[model samples]
Target: MLEKKSEFTIYPITVLQDNIVWVWVHNCNAVVVDPSISEPVEKWLLEKNLSLKAILQTHHHDDHIGGTQKLIKRWPQAKVVASKKELKRIPFQTFSVGDNDVFHLMDSEIKVIEVNGHTNNHIAFYISKEATKYNILFPGDTLFSGGCGRLLEGTPTQMFESLCKLNSLPKSTKIYPAHEYTENNLKWALTLEPTNLSIIERLKLIQNKLQKGMTSLPSTLSEERKTNLFLRAENIDKFTMLRRHKDSWKC
Candidate 1:
């Protein structure tokens, strides 16, 4: 039997109310995703002796980019990657990428996926064929474990299409979203899909994880297929209805 080699290690640092700062480390160099604050991320990297190689911004939201400037100041050579279309919003971006553009970092290939529902220029990073894994999606706020991001700037149609694109990925793909909204999302989902055993079971498991103070994120595409109402949506109309219902739903 061949030993499995770890391609990357992801660190989830909870910041603010629900924002999660994801740090992807490979060979002592790190790439941060949607860092809401700088101090903790800076301290974490320093303690691990890992160099900050780049910052991947999915949107221009303040919580996502507030730490970029400070992190760049600590590691001036670190690349700040963001959507080229949002130059005015994310002006500090050193590497302005567009839809479908492929870039290399930390011995892995990253493909930029434009998902404009949460924000007009929101983008997701997809890493396929990393070490032995088939896929990994850093979907910012576009897609969550059991729910999706609010339609802040884009329309339901845009969000629907963006989610369709994500659902097309391999089932084994691991998702690393920007926030820790799984427990709440799943709770709301269960109310909507009362008869869905998959949703019920998943919610119970996630609730247990939360009680134990463990993260219930980085959910697999397969898991979402069974329990995520957004991913299971069959048509745009269905997606729009679900989005509306969730938007009005409290708790």
Candidate 2:
């Protein structure tokens, strides 16, 4: 099995101004995460000769699931995996999952983590194989490179707890968030702690990546620990304050 041999890489497709559609591939099969649109993704997959195996929906938001039905039309065999709790919104879900449910995809173990702050029943997929060097987290709109999603449907406490769960993953875990917001997020963090070298250095690096038209994401948990203010918050009160501040922050 590919799980035993361990071969996979996640490719990012930038779309819809800021949304990033991650495609995890192994042995000519691909699994898409929150495709904001279909044409670009379809062209990329076809060019690579990859077969669509599944689509993982993290939330019911239009930007997240808008391209799903079209992709399904292109590949009727592709499975649409989503939260069972959001059946009404994500009615096309073929594999309805819940928090902590483990499933196999492309020979890797994929665990569903309910991260409800971005939206009620929003989930993240944590993928790992025994021989894999690093675990990969598709955190949809929950945990970003240097920040977290807004409290759209849940409270600060729930968002805090959700982040804690993600933070508990291996330090080597590679975080693949759904947007290219690292530069702005880090810039915002720097405003709070201008003397913090970690934030300053990272912001510079992220800025360079942006200038080069490169993605500064798939950030490791280790990096986030040093640079992401939301990940560094020690308590719920602090998390709440940070959330409120970030919401009103300009950059």
Candidate 3:
């Protein structure tokens, strides 16, 4: 996940509970994803003298879009991008997008992927540039490092299909999930597969990061394929069972 100085750098700003606000930086402009709060993000941008180019909303969850309005108040020109189908829920969206819609921003192309499961219209943003070595996926509360989002508003079949859609992406893609849930997800996975060495090693490495006060994310699809139980689920039935088990799991 190390990068040579490039035109873009997307990283996380950890916030309430486990929510992560992903800020994509390109030159002097910044695009924020799912800002759970505005004060810290606004302060950070102002300190760095970066203009808010846009705000990408993945869903209507309060924790996800809670800061959009407030953020726009400071940078009125910053576009609010969200699901076109959820206009009532996300009324402030300046640019509406749907599944598979491709848009250009900050000199890079972004693909809007409808990953509806955590919520009916939940979406993930993917960015792939010829100038960068790795692609980026900002899966808002949909695909976590070691798990998938809870099916709060969609069926298990819906969530399974969504995960499959994501799994088909190139393995080198870097996933910036909306929460620091890797440690907990891996811990639960270990309970199901006690001898899984991949899970064991990842849990250890992630624990080290947590201990040092770092976010254990920006995981590659390659790493998830090796250790993420949900991603490895062979069928919808298997995925559903794992989802149920994870829902009751305490970690």
lDDT: which is higher, 2 or 3?
2
Local error of candidate 3 at residue 10 (angstroms): 1.8
| Model 3 segments more than 4 A misplaced | 1-6
Among these predictions, the greatest lDDT belongs to 2
lDDT of 2 by residue, 89-153 (tens): 99999999999999998888999999889899999999887785659999999999999999889
Instruction: Look at candidate 1 and tell me the lDDT of residue 60.
Output: 95
- Once fitted onto the true fold, the runs of candidate 2 whose alpha carbons sit more than 4 angstroms away are 1-6
* Candidate 2 local lDDT, residue 202: 86
For all predictions, the C-alpha RMSD in Å is 2.9, 2.5, 2.3
Q: Candidate 2: worst 10 consecutive residues by lDDT?
A: 1-10
Model 1, TM vs. native = 0.96
- Candidate lDDT values, in order: 0.91, 0.92, 0.91
| lDDT, candidate 3, 122-144, per-residue tens | 98999898766659899988899
